[model samples]
Target: MEEYKKRIIKAIQYIDNNLDAELSLEKVAEIAAYSPFHFHRIFRLIVGETLQNYIIRKRIEKSAFYLALRKNLSIKDIYHQFGFSNHSGFNKTFKKYYGKSPSEFRKLAPENFHKIQAKQSKNGQIDTVFDQYICNIENLLNWTNMHLKIKVTALPEMNLAAVMSLGIANVESSFNTLVDWAKTENLFPGENVKMISVYHDSFKVTPPDKVRIHACMLLDEPLKRQQGEVFPEIIEAGKFIIGSGEVTLSDFEQCWVSLFLWMKENNYSVRKAFPFEIYHTNFKEHPEGKMAVDFCIPIN
Candidate 1:
């Protein structure tokens, strides 16, 4: 079982690294040290999809990212870069999966979707301007980079001082605001304090306007009652899958994907408790763009 997992992971890594290049079932199977016949069946059984479907899904997802992020690139160019044969083929497949064409997906970006739509009425002026500041991620964490290893462990109950945000698209800003508030209130007593962020709902299942999350710090003592969004809470003791790694803004979602895939492959079921991130270092201060964090998901 373990050997199968390792080989599948290797193939996934090969696929991710070479997405821009030609990726054939034979090539991937070679990377996995399996015959193409055996590899195809095992991949479908383990990953819950056929190898061809996985490749198409990945290509589309990456094209979606380029559609939003790379405004200067023509839609045709973006599809070509991802190995799609032509524009019509890409358009048909993209709309089938995302319910929109590439152009429609780009216009549907949360930051400028309405603005661009309104502008189209008068002068036909559109915001082809790509904003890096836009939190344009929608199901972007399709899969992980395959380097993350998930560990299952038991956690004791935690008392936390939390600052929460509702309906915010940029989660990092919320986290930073909470940490700033904590510092302003002299909440940090020592260097060992654990920083945590509770993800209350799945991005796919919940409306973005109704999404809720809490940024929290482990409290050694009871916090005085406050009237604002920041408050006290407890995380109950439970079993969890923990994946720790250095993450940047670009790959953070992929880390979550890794854990979710790990859970599926290992036959572990997720519990109702919210998945959370535990920060091991001050992310803002990291010299490298990456931050060290343990992605924690409670499971039965």
Candidate 2:
């Protein structure tokens, strides 16, 4: 298990460093010193998805966040940043996951972007109410020596209804269940919607079977509270280190370890809540080989 863990970490680092270059599962497995056949199975058993699915999800998720926050960037520029060889390929992938063209998602931001009003406590200290920590890669111990450039940012409060899973959560299945329930209940308003997973355990110490996850949403209106169900709650706003790239499930530990190393080295502290994952792409529409999710790590 320890040996597998090391190989997984190396694979994640390779993916992070080569996002803009051509990457193949077989090649990535080679880097991990595993045969493609066994590697693919192990990766899925650990990560819950195939290698290609993980990569596509990370690339698209990264592009989506930039599209939302960096309005000045062009679609073409975003595509190049993720290593799409041409505009057509990027558009197809983007539309498949997001349910809209990049231009469409950008256009919705003006009206749909939820502007969070910064809150202050009467004590005069910047109400650490949603105090968030942001860590850049320069401070990370594991990747500090690597040449990657990374940044961290603070995110505003969001409203969501979530289903809590106490043990190893089948995230893909749980997300589908939530969406189906939301659709049946009209939770999605056709404006942009976000799917988030709040993590309650340190990925490092928590066994995959013992991890907890909350499937949540970013909503504007109050949801009809359900009996025996967790209600919509405000995720206190905070700082987060937002990073993107693909990694197999087996490699998830390395990705998280790298993030935590960044936090510790940067003098930032982790919030007690579990980290949340945002799905920027529509998985149902994308080919199974291509899917993306964005990870948001809350900081203090």
Candidate 3:
């Protein structure tokens, strides 16, 4: 069973690394070292969807993020980037899955979707209701299985070439697409580009599939205006208590729990805006076992 789980993860990694390339179920199954037929059964039972369906959903979600955030890229370019051969096929598949044409969905989402609507902090004060119940960090570290150091800092306003997606079922793929978009745009000239995730809700209340992930690049100049969309907006300047750590992929939940516990123990109220996970180190350059991230929590 343990070996099967490792195989499944390997299969997922392959799909993630080669989403734009031609991928077949047989090929993916072979990577898992399982017979194609048995692999299909095990994959569906373990991952809850057929491989093709999962891939399609990931592509659609990624394309939707581009449409929402980057105004310069046309629907055609976006479609082709995700491996769709033509615009017509892309449109048809997207409409079928999302129940609206891409253009229409983009136009209506800002007004209709609860997650898309931006709510400014009331009176510029952070809400501390959740902070009341937090136990001390020393106690939390001793009580919890994971421990990490945290620092508080003020972040200045910065512009970002961002791709925003709601109800992101597959974050790894969505994030990879955003990184690719950033690279294609030449947003990171000679400097290292960090990946930031802005969280709007607590993990307990939000399912992983329903989480909002914003992949962003800090920029210097204002973006050139595109024809009919909004460019990157300023991530407002504020005080944030930042948590930095390296965790195995399987231990991500514990990393988050430690951060939340720290925030609670310190009586820090969270701002009801996007919380960003800033990627300080490039994964391509780092060792496979170590992934570094800075979880930036807006505080009062």
Off by over 4 Å in 1: 1-146, 168-173
Each prediction's Cα lDDT score? Answer: 0.67, 0.60, 0.62
Ranking by lDDT: 1, 3, 2
lDDT tens digits, residue span 180-209, model 1: 767787876467878888875444323354
Candidate 2 wrong stretches, greater than 4 Å:
1-149, 188-191, 227-230, 246-251, 282-290
Count of clashes in candidate 1: 0
RMSD of each: 19.2, 21.1, 16.6
Tens digits of per-residue lDDT for model 3 on 1-300? 545655775676577557677778899999989999999988887666788887776677666655654446788878887779987898888766555677876675432222221222456521111222244445556644444558889989877655444445656654665566556677644466666666533343333554545556666775664211123545789888887776555555556666655665566766534667777775666677557877777777
Pairs that collide, model 3: 197-277, 198-275, 199-275
For model 3, the stretches where C-alpha displacement exceeds 4 angstroms are 1-140, 143-147, 224-231
Ranked by TM-score, the better of candidates 2 and 3 is: 3
Clashing pairs in 2: 47-249, 57-291, 57-292, 97-281, 97-282, 132-239, 133-299, 199-274
lDDT of candidate 2 over 1-300, digit per residue (tens): 545644664665577567787889889999989999988987776556688976775577556655654556788888898888888888888766655677886775332322211233465422112122233334434443352233688777777877545346566666665677778678764567877777754332233553556777777765566423334546777888765654334434445546555555566655534476676666556655333555567766
* Minimal lDDT window, size 10, model 1: 112-121
